[model samples]
Target: MTDTLKIALAQLNPTMGDIAGNLALLRKARAEAAARGADLVIASEMVITGYPTEDLVLKPMFLEAAESALQALALDTADGGPGMIVGGPWRQDPTARPPLYGKVYNTAYVLDGGKVTTHRTKHDLPNYGVFDEKRVFGAGPLPGPVNFRDVRLGVMVCEDMWKPDVSECLEESGAEILIVINGSPYELDKTEERIQLAVQRVNETSLPVIYVNQVGGQDELVFDGASFILNEDNGLACQLPAFEEALEVTEWYRGPAGWTCNPAHREAPAGGMEPIYGALMLGLRDYVNKNRFPGVIIGLSGGIDSALTAAVAVDALGPQRVHTVMMPSPYTSQESLDDAAEAAQLMGIGIDSVSIEPAMQAFNTMLQPILNGAAAETNAGDTTEENIQARSRGLTLMAISNKLGYMVLSTGNKSEVSVGYATLYGDMVGGFNVLKDLYKMMVFDLARWRNQVLPKGALGPAGRAIPERIITKPPSAELKPDQKDEDSLPPYAVLDDILKCLIEGEESVDAIVARGHDRELVNRVWRMLELAEYKRRQACPGVKITRRAFGKDRRYPITNAFRGPA
Candidate 1:
């Protein structure tokens, strides 16, 4: 038996639908590992087809392409002599009986010396929030262990490592080490949770675990690649960096006690708000770059929301790629205009001032004929006026987008998105919404945090990227005179708390109301959220920082009659 085995963890950022590109990356990693005399190279879950391909995996041609890619990968690794554990979609008999032969599996294939030997299917298929694996992939019945270089290794996919049953089965089958390939997405403190789980698994089975995770932004989801290896004694052996792609090579030597990993070189920790900030930056950068968008343009109102959005845009793409348009309406404040110009100048981004008064007047004048008999003093006219202003701004932004080939970014926060305070076709009109899932309170906190911990090459103002008045003053849509967000809705502190309970905690209305909230307010908020489902459904894609973001993660019916406590 070999006393030591060298293992390579390939933490790669894969682009979805790029089968050939993904395969090339896999082969490159394999070649590098082989050059280093490593025994095996382990990749992340679904590395070939990319993670969360969603319904794309169900397509026959897609599956065929994936299968072909897998064959090519196997052939590439044939002469390398180093084994590889790669994750991809596999076909089952589509026309089988009760057990269903055609059911596809979220599987990992073990290839060595040009031959595919072992295959393991994921056991615990997570169906909750952002995971629909149960609906797509079939569970595997076998819990067999694979033996390579006299080492009995247990391999499991992402969720399989989270469960005890699968780990126990592998341990019982005489597995020496547990290698888990994951496609885990990033949330606030998900890295800590993953560490705890890995430690718990090691304590349970007395086996060291090596976790390799995919890293990249996929639409709303961002996978932070902070892969690690933990010893059976529940000690941290090695940890890779977060929010970046890295190839980690570590050696495991057999000792009198058992296999002990050589002390892993740890990268600098992205502590506190760094990971979150890095996640947003990477998510935004990838979303723009991957989609082939030339540049991004945001409507800057000098408010904290737009100010923060502008800062993030400039950080994600350089100042040259970020353009700001200040669309002042009748209710626009002079202070707001000054702040907008200041922020644009500080960031060195292009700024254009376009007054909406002309467009707003034209819209009202055109509608005057149809509304000749309508009451001018009614609140309906006020509402129409506000909507027309919003729509006019949307039209102007869309025109700039069409002319300059820039993608408009919607600047609505979760507080407004949650309670339907945002105009669907107005402020919500954009190719992407950066702060859709960030609460208003969080927006303020993040702005402060950004000011304190500015990015390395930030061009924006050094301190307080957002104006102090904007953060201190009550939020307003600036649609009408004396319009404050508090006048139409609850305070952000209370609103965000209630929303966290309802949206993230999934607490019922009565449950939320029982938490010292007014029943009427809870009911109103719930109704607004329900009614705004259609709008959210049609809203632009944004990064999902929260656990229960209103994207693919939180799928709800638009026409549902379901209501919370009356």
Candidate 2:
């Protein structure tokens, strides 16, 4: 039995469905770890086929491809380099008949001595909110510890470590060290929760736990690679940085007491708005780059939503790849125009000024005679005209996007989206929405936070990507003369609080009223939130930052009639 061990945690980013590319990345990480004198390398869950493959795991050809890649990786250990523990989908019974053809488990393979020595499957399959693993993958049996080079290594998948059963089984079966490979996605303040859970397991087993998580964007989910290690004493031994790919080699030695880790690199956990901003930046970057978009185009309306979107785009794709345009109507103020121009210059991106007055006038003239006929007189209102202006700008952005091959980035936030305040095809038209899950108040808070400090690995300017005036000014859509968002909706501070209760809290109308909101206003906000489900259903995908993001986290019926307590 060995008394000393060297294992490397490989925190990496894997693109979904790119088997060859992911294998190359893993090979590179293994080489780097081998050079550091690591005896074994542990990668995040599903590094070969990417995490949450969804229905792709159901495909026979895809599974075969993944198995092939895993075999090829197993062969790489023949050079007497570091062995690897990699996660992938494995057919539980490959020789089973037709009905069991696609039955696969989320399995981790232990590769050494030119072959896969043994494998462990995940016992728990997550089913709620952004996870539907139960539908795609079968639950694995509770596993015993994996014997690696005479050391008893307790191996668990992502959710397996969340509870005590798997760890208990491993410990009872003679596990000396606990190693968990994960594809855990990022949510606000979730890092602390993960650490707390690890501590709980450590307290239970008195065994050091090493957690490895992937980093990158997959659809709306963004994984932060805050992989870490906790000693038997429940103290942090190592921590990889969040939102960045890194590899750390940890040395473990068995003492008279038990296994102990030599304290290694521990990056200070990201706090405050740092992780939030990193999530947004990395989410946008991976989405654009992975989907092969040349760049992003934003409709910079001199509003907080659009301004923040532009800043994020600049930081994500660099100034050369980001483009902005100002589509002004007759009611567009000179201050707004100047602000848009200044913000564009500050971010060092090109801005084009395009007036939508022509489209507005044409639509009005075309509809005037029909309305003058008296049949449509009752239906005509200022809202129709305002929406026309919004649609005209949307059309302008789409036209530019078509010509330049750049994706149009929508700028509406959760507050506007939740209340049906945003025009559907107008402000909501985009291939992606960076602020889709963020509220208006969060938009303001992030804008202020971003200006004060340059985020790590930011491609934008050092300070003040947004002008101070833009933040302090009252938010307006500029669709009508002297228009402000408050004209139709409640104050953002109050509205966002109510929304948090309704969307994230899922509190009933009366429960929300108990939180010091007007009863009638609470009911009204709930009504608006329910009515806007259709729009949200059709909205583009954005980063998932909150515990209850709109898309996969909160799934409400669009055509429902369930009015809670009056």
Candidate 3:
């Protein structure tokens, strides 16, 4: 038995489809590990193609490129440096396969002495909560441990570590310590949940576990990368930072009591809007930067949502790259205009005004025959006019996007979008939305949070990016005279709580009302949410910060008529 085993966890940021870049990162990490004399270096899940490759893994070229890169990495390790357990896509023969098989797995290759020794596939392909692994990866059988430098190191790629059976099987197969590689995305309290999960496995197996995760944003998903080591007793030995890239070697001792990692740095896990804010920053940054958008343009309404969206965009793309446009209508109050300008000054981004009244007037003139037809006779204060104004703003933003080469940033928060409060192709029009998963209440909280702290890794300067008045004022669409959001929907606190119950908990209205809400209100909220699924279906893709975001996470049928409570 080995007296000591040193393992280096490579908590890295890998760009999607950047095989050469990912390999270079792996080689550098390997070099760092070798310098530290680590026995084996471990990287996160799919470090070659980046995690959650989504539909890209379906392309044979992408799979082949990743495999080739993995081979290149293996050849480089021939220099007799530290052995590595690097994660990547591994293509299997598809002659005998099911429909869901990419035949390529979310796999990890254990390379030692210039050859790929053990290529382990991922078990437990998670289908829910921002993951569609089962669609892309064929399920791996229960993995056994790989004997590396006299240590039986069991590998669990991402989803494998989430459940018990994988670890149980590994333990039964004589695995001493577990090394878990993850592309786990950031959600509220997921860091602590990971620790607890690792603890559960350790308790079940009586072996220390090393949990390593990828750090960065991949489209909507943000991997926090709070990798750590847990002792056999489930005590935290070493912990890497969350939402950032890092690498550290942890020493382990294998005595009669099994393996125990040496005590190392313990990062105090960040909670509340800070982590959520960081997720938004990273998700937005990666989407804009990786896709090579010159900049982003946001229609700043001077409301909490748009203000917060602008703040996050500036923080993500920096002030120079974030452009704010105030497309005011006839009903747009002077207060909103002033606040928007103030917000732009604070965020250090340029703000321009394009009055939509001209467009609205032109639309009204053009649509007068249709809008003033028999349909107008029945309705007073019709929303058709409101939507026209909104669509005009949308048109202007799209034009700016086309002419100026700026990707439009949608500013709708989850609360408004959840109930279809946003106009179709109007406020919902954008290339991306960083605030899509954040509820209305969360927008207020994060705006306040952004003002207080210069969020770590944020490029924008601090100091009240969101005007305080914007947060304190009642949120409104200002499509008509005195248009407050509460007129169309319930209070945000009640609304957000109910949404949490329905969207995340999948709770019935009866269950929701049982939690002290009025039954009628729950039913109404449930109705709005159900009715809005169609709108959500057409909404732009956005960063997913919550456990159950609208797009990929929640898949409610639009044609369904299932109502809850009353």
Candidate 4:
């Protein structure tokens, strides 16, 4: 009997729908595990087709392709080397009529000694907040344990481990150890939650648990891989680094008392802005590279938002790989231009200057007929003219993006996007918005943090990359004469707090008003948020850094008439 076993947890990043590429990665991971003397290797859930494959699983050809890839991988695991557990989509038999036999299951298969031995599917399917697993997969029944040499192992996929009944079932089936494969996306404090859950399960079942997770940025979601192992005694044995790919090997020995985990190796904690910063960088790099963009282009308005975005782009891709453009209109201040130029210089990136005077004039000339005589004056409404300037600038940036092969990075903060302060199809025209989920207050904090502690191996400007004037200045769109953001919206400090309550806390208008906020202010903000749903739906994808983002994480109907009482 195998008294001592080496298990490898492959925490890797897999691209969606890239079956061949994903298979290659799996093979490479398997080789690494084998080299490290691992007796068994485990990967994250849905490793073949990637997590949250959504509608791709509905296609028969896609399932066949995934199955073929899995078979090829199983063949590669021949020669009685290390056993492998891989995740993919599996279809049940088509004959049984009552329970819908042809249902799809999010499954994991264990391949050992040149053959497929056991399979298990996810039982609990999550359907809230960026997940539609129930729409795709059928709930799987409780699976039995798999015997490997002397030890009995139970496998759980993703959501299975979240519930206590599954672990209890595994314990009842006489399993000595439980292994969970997850494709859990990163949320702030999610790692702590995972550790607590693992400890709880270990204490309840009196069996050691190994949790393996996927790592990478898929569209708006970022997965932080922090695989861990807990002993039957409810003690943490080992933990891998977050936001990275690692092949962690743990040794288990059968003692006189029972099976116990050996003193496992651990990596140093990569905290203090490392995880969030790396997530942002990876999201940016993959979004640009995966979309086949040659590089990225950003409009560097002389504001903290654009400055940070520019820095992020330069860090994600090299400075040479980024292009900056400063499109200043008539209302744009000379100080802003100077700061923008200084930022470009500091970052060692070139910038092009395009004045929007010509385009603004053309727009005004064209709109004169529709506007009639009274509204066509030079001194029109401040917001109307300011929005026109912003639209003109957006058009110019988009043209440059089209002329040159580059993806545009929008620089709007969450505060602006939340309040409908941004112009639709104007400043919002971009392939990706870097800080769309970041509040204005958090934006300032992040800028300060970046300046203080430069990220690992960052190549951008070192000390205070953002100009002091940009950070200190009152934020303005510079669309009309002396137009400041405060003129329209509340101060960022007050605005962000209210937004946090309304969006993240889901506070009603009455609740917000009850929190010492003015009744009129709460109602106005709520109205703005409700009206902005349509614009947000049309907005581009952005990295999600907040608990609730405007993208897939928060889905509100655009055509709803359920306004609160006035």
lDDT of model 4 at residue 260?
A: 76
Tens digit per residue, CA lDDT, model 3, 1-566: 67887889999999998999999999999899899888889999889888788878877777778878888888877887789998887777733333436576888899988889888899889887677887877888888888887888888987788789999999999999888988888888888888888999998999888999999888778888999998898788998888888989888887888888898778888877788888888888888888899999999888888888888888877899988899988789999999999999998989999998777777666776875552232222478888888899999999999999999999898988998899998989998988899888878888888899999888888676888899899888998888898898889999999989988898876788889999888888888888989999999888887788888888888999666423
Clashes of 4: 0
**Clashing pairs counted in every model:** 4, 0, 0, 0
The lDDT ranking, best first, is: 2, 3, 1, 4
Q: List the residue pairs that clash in candidate 1.
A: 92-102, 93-101, 93-102, 94-102
Model 3 score (lDDT)? 0.86
lDDT of 4 by residue, 115-153 (tens): 777789888888878888888789898977778766788
Residue-by-residue lDDT tens digits, candidate 1, 272-298: 767776777778877888788998989
Give the clashing residue pairs of candidate 2, or none: none
Give the number of colliding residue pairs in candidate 3.
0
Q: Tell me, what's the RMSD of every candidate? A: 2.8, 1.9, 2.3, 2.3
What lDDT does each candidate get? 0.84, 0.91, 0.86, 0.84
**Regions of model 2 farther than 4 Å from truth:** 95-102, 369-380
Query: Which runs in model 3 stand beyond 4 Å of their true positions?
Result: 94-102, 373-381, 564-566
Give me candidate 2's TM-score against the actual structure: 0.97
> By TM-score, is 2 or 4 better?
2
Q: What's the C-alpha lDDT at position 464 in model 1?
A: 51
Model 2 Cα lDDT, one tens digit per residue, 1-566: 79999999999999999999999999999999999999999999999999879888887788889999999999999899999999999997665433432378998899998999999999999999999898878889999998899999999999999999999999999999999999999999889999999999999999999999999999899999999999989989999999999999999999987899899999999788889999999999999999999999999988888999999999888999998999888788999999999999889989998988778777877888876633232323578877888889889999999999999999999999999998989889999999988999889999999999899999998888998889999999987778899998999999999999988888887787888999888888888989999999999999999989989899989999999633
